[model samples]
Target: MFLPTTVEEVERLGWKELDVILVTGDAYVDHPSFGVALIGHYLLSKGYRVGVIAQPDWHSGEDITRLGRPRLFFGISGGNVDSMVANYTASMKKRKTDDYSPGGIGGKRPDRAVIVYSNLVRRFFPKVPIVLGGLEASLRRFAQYDWWSDTLRKSILLDAKADLLVYGMAEKAVLQIAQTLEKTKDITSCHGIPGTVFWTSQRPENGIELPSFEEISQDKSKYAKATALLQFWTDPYRNVLIYQKQDNRYVVQNPPQLPLEQEELDRLYLLDFERRTHPYYARMGTVPALEMIQFSITAVRGCYGMCSFCALTHHQTTHVLSRSIDSIIEEAKMLTKHPDFRGTISDVGGPTANMYNSKCQRRETQGQCKKFCLHPAVCENAKVTHEDYLELLEKVKSVEGVKHLFVSSGIRHDLILMDKDADRIIKKLVDFTPGQLKLAPEHAHPKVLKLMRKPPAELFLEFKRRFESLSKTLSKKRYVIGYFIVAHPGESMHENDYLKKFIQRNLGYHPQQIQIFTPSPGTLSTAMYYTGIDPITGEEVFVERSLKHRNKMKQNVNTNG
Candidate 1:
């Protein structure tokens, strides 16, 4: 909660008085890379007075009106509302036929019609010039296949009735939109913004004119395939297009940066830390917990681990960069000043947490070599060492408020074990980590592992044994292994059975997590589902995880444990 300041003070900041209000369904204030905080900061930087309405109960219209109405609206989302609705709708059908529902036969509509939090604001205040952006909006920018409904879906712009849709990194696009709205008050005029998409009302009725996406030229084949699937976008009826009104044409702008280079990564981290810290700490009357206690820091912007079943790599791209150790140490110092600051640092890494300063180095002529050179299989490169990472951990642990520092992020076992310096870092992590360590060995079978492009199950077992031994010697807490995607394409019953038996024999039957496989849009798995052939091998496969089967698997795991 923020202290009440006079509206005059807010107006003196050169912000317009109450023209727009940004609403969100996320609980946390600083979501690191995601959520409304980043955009809110960007808007404030552009001289827009914005107030965040976090985690509002959308079931009641009265709850929404408490923040006061606005001339324009911004809604932000974190991919939960849509998942909840899908789960609710599915469960209702399974209920006893004779049971009468008290809330009527209809589902609860969220405050916003679109998945992005911004679009939801438009649902309550229609014709108020709404703008939607975030992960939900970014991924669904163009017509794409939705596995749950087994149909195509249109861009969220049409479905949410938002005036404009911003994709990828929201900072630049959001600032541009705020500046334009403050000047002209017309969203259509701001269509040419680098990372935004909007309907051209003046275009022909048969097909809408879409702005040429810069990425489309670089990756023409991918764009062509994505465009061809446009016709498949449909609602539950599988007839009416999900997003209608403008001709079916959609534009997907080039995201701010596809794969951030080392220098860019450092710049983003430095700038964000500087901008977000002071205001955030001052508003709360203490340093934010995210800075000190438990928060994730992105050491690298994108992931190179192109796991077929994972979405992070597909959307964020498969490039890696490491932030400077100096920047990380400075940020750690800032976290120590929080009033409720915990002694423990939850995580000190990014996407694949343990990957720090690990880059492919290529020797060139004239005795000069490229620093942080990205190789084809960068993780497996010999020169990419973890000495810097070990030094980084040591520096963070030396911070005044930080009593115990732990690495809670995913560990790339193969990368850690391959390099001697990286292995030393892993050894230190295991010996010093406070609580349960988390690692995602997504699958056990070699076939499944290969499909995921992950290291073999044997390697994970080896790492687990090594960690367990180290933990016992150091008297540390137990470790938890995260195994996900039970019914991915090409997974056989025999493979699952073998995996279950392997868990029973090695790590005991009681596993902490077993997540169901969800086929996210724009992944390698989705491509396989569409073409009915494995994208990597072109082999035919079968995916057989129904709701009932997933439930049964959970039950079986519990009973076996």
Candidate 2:
């Protein structure tokens, strides 16, 4: 059943007042893929009366107050994607459309949506506890580089005046908050919970203090150092507590919540999600995001790719969490019963489809590995395999109503190349992929790929050759579509030229998918973009700050210059 979004829906559910109200910047889709839905559903599963206020009007208190006041706390999210990224492009222009919106229109959400919604709720219900989560809050939990403003901003918790900020996949932390508030009746008592950040005047003992916001904002080198330190201490098992002084108060971040056990992860996806946007939103128009994923299933939760330009590690962490096969097949069987089921599962994977069941026992015993897991070389301790994933897919396909199951999520090419059973994996992926296998090689130049923490270009080429050969052997016509990034932190015109030549000499065609680097918050690449220094190696990098030059470099590569 869908979580109540309106007071009428709440009343129909026989609830006098909601225990928690979730505010988001996206149209409500009660699917597990959406964070707000997943969290709202989880709270309901625990017997809390939860409601959602999606894409409320920030200009007035009317829309924000429609659900009335919650008995417990208000949860705010900047939707699935960050507000700044949703509202603006890489070149910092206002985006004309938002996929998560009712009609796929832009301007439905405001800039800094999390902060805006939190302040809006505070204006109406001044004393209600406000909890912030989702991509925007998670990535900005620490003071980091803000690309749109070109300034280092303080943590979103301080800017939003939120009582608590839940980072990463926040199902566990948020439930703990609800439980704590139900018993103690004081929101502040919920501080120091795993996966939560709160501000305190007293310095936290034994906490690793990052460079203060004042220090990092002024000194780029210090900012890089802080970024490195925060990432280094991200493991939940490590039990590292980190804090950074904003001004007078210090923001203390407890160690992340441990990866949910298989049973715990399995239960979250089995919730009775309608798998469609709420009727209220459906009447407005088709939500583009929902349309794409309503038929898809999230087979996994977290990723361990740890790419420099990606924020998956900071938000989802480097842990690769997969649900049990029986649980996934159960969800697949349920999907077939839905009225909208068309016998095809659009996707059955997470951040990286092939990373399912990929485990690193060494990292679990000893904290996060100091070495790169998949960048320069796949670490020996990192066991990259596809046996379990292949079995999971085969079982899902064997479901009575399931006809076609596609692995649409980006496949880590490095993993496939490193796997011992490469032939079987490639053949299965070719059969599963509709036609084009999505691979993100990022760039061809060695220095730029190194700065981006991507594998050597030669590895990608070898994988492509094997994949295309397998497609031919299996009598399927399939091709590898490469995703490239131009003008990243270390890429100059010379490096971009190398990328252009590589495309011409290797692929023989200008690949359609290419993007200019945006340098968003909470990414190692963004730090290098802002500081012109790689934090890990402490070496200088060339950054293209000029918009014209950045655009020209992309144009040159696209035009096959």
Candidate 3:
């Protein structure tokens, strides 16, 4: 069942007051893929009366006030994707449409959406405690560079004036927050929860202090140092309370919440989701994002690939968590019963398709190592395998009503080459993949690839050769397409030219999935973008900040296609 979106619906449910209210920037689609829906259903199962106010108008109190104030607090998210990225393109021009909005409208959500919605809620209920979560709040919890404004910005906790902020996948932290508010009735008292950050006037004892916001704003080197420190302290088992002085007070971030165990992850997926947009928004039009992913299955969460430009490393962490195959098959069976059932299941993988069931004992005993699992080369400790995943694909495909199952998630081609059973895994992937298989080899230059913490260009070329050979042997006319990033830190016109030649000569096509780098908050590449120095090694790197130059590189790469 869908959560009540209006007062009339709330009344229809015969509930006098709601325990928690979630406000978001996207049209509410009650599917597990949507963050608000997953969180709302999780809270509801825990016996909290939850409601959602999605895409509320920031200009007035009408839509914001419809749900009124919750008995506990208001949880704000800028939808699944960050609002700034959703509203603008890499070139900083406004986008034409948003897939998450009803009818795929462009301006349904405002920029800095979490801050805007929090302030709007405060206008009507000044006394109600406001809590912030989702990608915008999670990434912006510290002072970082903003690409759109082209300036350093303070933490969203201070700017939004929110009482607290929850980072990472927040199932555990949010439940604790709800329970604390119910018992104590004071938001400030709800500190010391893992996966939460709050402002405090007093200095916290036994906490590591990051460079002050004032210091980092003025000194680029200091900012780079702080970014490195944060990444180093991300392990939940070994991390301590870390604080940063913003101005008059300190922003204290508790240790990260540990990745949920298998059973916990399995239960979250089995929640009651309608798997469609609510009728309230459906009357407007269909959401294009839901249409693409409604049939897909999220078999895993978190990724070990610490690519410099990707946010999954910071948001989901470097530890991989996967659900049991029995749990996954059960969900696939549920899809067969849906009224919108088609024989095809669009996807059946997670952050990285092949990372499914990949585990290392060192992570449990010692926490994340400074060395990456796949980068440099696959570590000996990195037990990369595909036995369990191959079994999963076979079982899911044999389910009664399913005709085709595609592994649409990103696959780490480098891992496939390292696996002992590479031949069998590649054959299985070919059977499940649609016409084309996509691989993200960001650039061809070795220096740039090193700065991005990706495998050397030679590895990608070797993997492409093997994949093509296997396809030909199987009589499958499938093509391997490459994705590239332009103007990342340590990349320039010379590097872009090198990438163009590599694509034309080796890939034999002007690959279409090209994009200029945007410096979002809390990413290693963004740190390099802001500082012009690689954080890994304290050496200066080149960055293309000029919009004209960035656009020209993209255009040059796409010339022959």
Q: Which ten residues in a row have the lowest lDDT in candidate 1?
A: 96-105
459 in model 2: Cα distance from truth in Å? 1.3
Task: Give per-residue lDDT, candidate 3, residue 434.
Answer: 93
Stretches off by above 4 angstroms in model 1 are 1-20, 28-34, 56-75, 78-120, 123-127, 182-184, 199-247, 255-298, 360-383, 470-482, 526-531, 556-561
In candidate 2, list every pair of residues with a backbone clash.
Answer: none
- lDDT by residue for model 1 over 113-168, one digit each (tens)? 35534444556766667777666666666655566666555666666666777655
Q: Which consecutive 10 residues in model 2 have the weakest lDDT in total?
A: 362-371
Which digits, one per residue and each the tens of the lDDT, describe model 2 over residues 162-190? 99999999999999999999999898899
List the candidate 2 regions with Cα displacement exceeding 4 Å: none
RMSD of each: 8.7, 1.0, 1.2
TM-score, each model? 0.74, 0.99, 0.98
Which residues of candidate 3, in runs, are more than 4 Å off? none
Evaluate residue 370 in candidate 2 and report its C-alpha lDDT on the 0 to 100 scale. 75
Model 1 TM-score? 0.74
